[model samples]
Target: MDDSTLVASSKSGIEDRLSITAEFYTLNNVHANSAKYVLLFSSDPSSVIFFGLSPPPLINNNTLTLTSLALTTSFRFLGVWFSLSASSQFVLKQARSMVKDMAALLTLKKLLAQHVAYLYNAVLLSRLEFRLQTSLFFDSIVQSIIFPMFSIIKRKAGLASTTPLALLYLKIPFSIQHAFCRFLLGKKFLLILIFGNLPIMLFLIFKNLWVLRVVLLPST
Candidate 1:
């Protein structure tokens, strides 16, 4: 619980609970003076309303205190940016421009086709795959991201902009990439690990059974 999030319907509720938690931690010889929180009220702008004055400074038993949470329209957590406005055209616009630039520079060296293909996958596709798995993305966004990889292919092959999509990739020396399938397979591997571990499987069975019992219990 060193790094955690606190969510509440009002500013006072979060501050009150956090103070209590801080007290308990002080008794256990663990003190937290550094914590950051974002206040999100709505995905729609009109619904976002200020509830009260700024939260009081959070101080631990050591008398160390953190500054008040500042107003923010977006926040980055674990390398992903979430916008309060519910719109971000993905951060990889620059990643695409970067790959395109790298390809352009690599062309000057006249690298062999196989070498270019290797770099494209090892460097470019690998990053795209990592970003793909970070969160669930809309289909339209995925399609836009997918569309550029082929343009890179055509630029390298000296093909026309109107070159068929299949031919652009399938006919290339690298063969059509299965990155999306690979992303799906990565998720499937986690399921395999969860099922294979005996302790985890048993814990999951008991947890699920308890939940079902609670859910199916008659109302008072």
Candidate 2:
């Protein structure tokens, strides 16, 4: 089918699935009030064409009316900024704001190097590390913001820029740090697959293999 047809089919399938789930919950005496807060996000603008001329409202029990979530450039959810285009611009903006806040600490020159390092780790690094593994964030752009701050901290610690901050701070490089986080995330997901219910494990394995066959193998 054409791209437009596929998009329409996908949208219809989502609505059908939501209706089915709501019915299932109601029948089982389970209170599934997902319509109250569920947000329908379109990752691509072209997907809007799938909704037809007038998309139907998600009406539950002829009372709760759920409208299509308004298209937004970005929205914050659980402390992470998600953009419709999936760009790392939001993350970069947040990182810049954090750098500004952290830089203010540098004015306290009298603070010991270890103290400053502790503050940086506690205040700045903690924020940057949030949801690091799952998101396909622009690593280079983020590192550009981070490394300079690291250099500043290194200078405060009486270490030259050439001296690797990782050695002095007992931390890994930004790239390696992200790599480690990804590794941990993969392990966590793998554990879930292995120990989860048989149906779930089978479904996930099938999905992974399908992706590998359709995308990875063809690319290679």
Candidate 3:
């Protein structure tokens, strides 16, 4: 044969062998069963029939009760409002009983001691309740009381704003203090109420009035 004819015959033989392998792979379900290649025999295709092995029996659904509570790995704060309410009610009742029993003792010193402790607890409980209910009112009272006290302290420490008086009446801080001192030391003590504190008092009053007007105007 010529060189071209010989090459063509060799290619045809290789193609025929590949075609046979492909046909076998497509037609057969060849699976390795074990590490050592154990042959498994089966008849039913819908259900798996294990050969040379006894299958475990299925448990009956009705006989198996699933009362297993799903345990949550979490912290739950409030399970129910009844639990919290009942707890607070119990504490309140206990405190009331303690207070009543102490009152019944009737000795002055013991009564005072009991009253002091009760008052402290009552104040704390009232504060807690106030925070829970009427929060705005409680906050307003706190702000009103604290801000004025702070302002007074700031004023006494040579730090109070003299700008209002200065803007309204052209008086410096030293002059304001001097004026207060003179009012305390002279016949123009009426001017103490008139000048020293009058402006601050009037300013607060006017501020409150303006706020009230604004609040009421919306309603009206």
TM-scores for all predictions: 0.45, 0.46, 0.15
Best lDDT goes to which candidate?
A: 1
Q: Could you give me the TM-score of model 2 versus the true structure?
A: 0.46
Candidate 3 residue spans exceeding 4 A from truth: 1-87, 106-220
List, residue by residue over 1-220, the lDDT tens digit for candidate 1.
3354555545455545556555655466554434333334332232323323233343333222333322234445445554433444444454456556776667566655556666766776677666544344554555456565555556667779897766735645656555555556656654565568765765554331100000111223
**CA lDDT scores, all candidates in order:** 0.49, 0.47, 0.27
- By summed lDDT, the worst window of 10 consecutive residues in model 3 runs over 208-217
Looking at model 1, residue 52 earns an lDDT score of: 31
lDDT string for model 3 (1-220, tens) is 1001001123234234323433332355322112221111111112221212112232111111111111121111121111111123433333344434433443333323234334323442343332222111233333332233223323433454542433221232221222222223443444455558686775554331100000011111
Which has the higher TM-score value, candidate number 2 or candidate number 3? 2
Question: What digit string (tens of lDDT, one per residue) describes model 2 on residues 136-176?
Answer: 44446556666656666677767778885457545532222
lDDT at residue 194 of model 3 (Cα atoms): 57
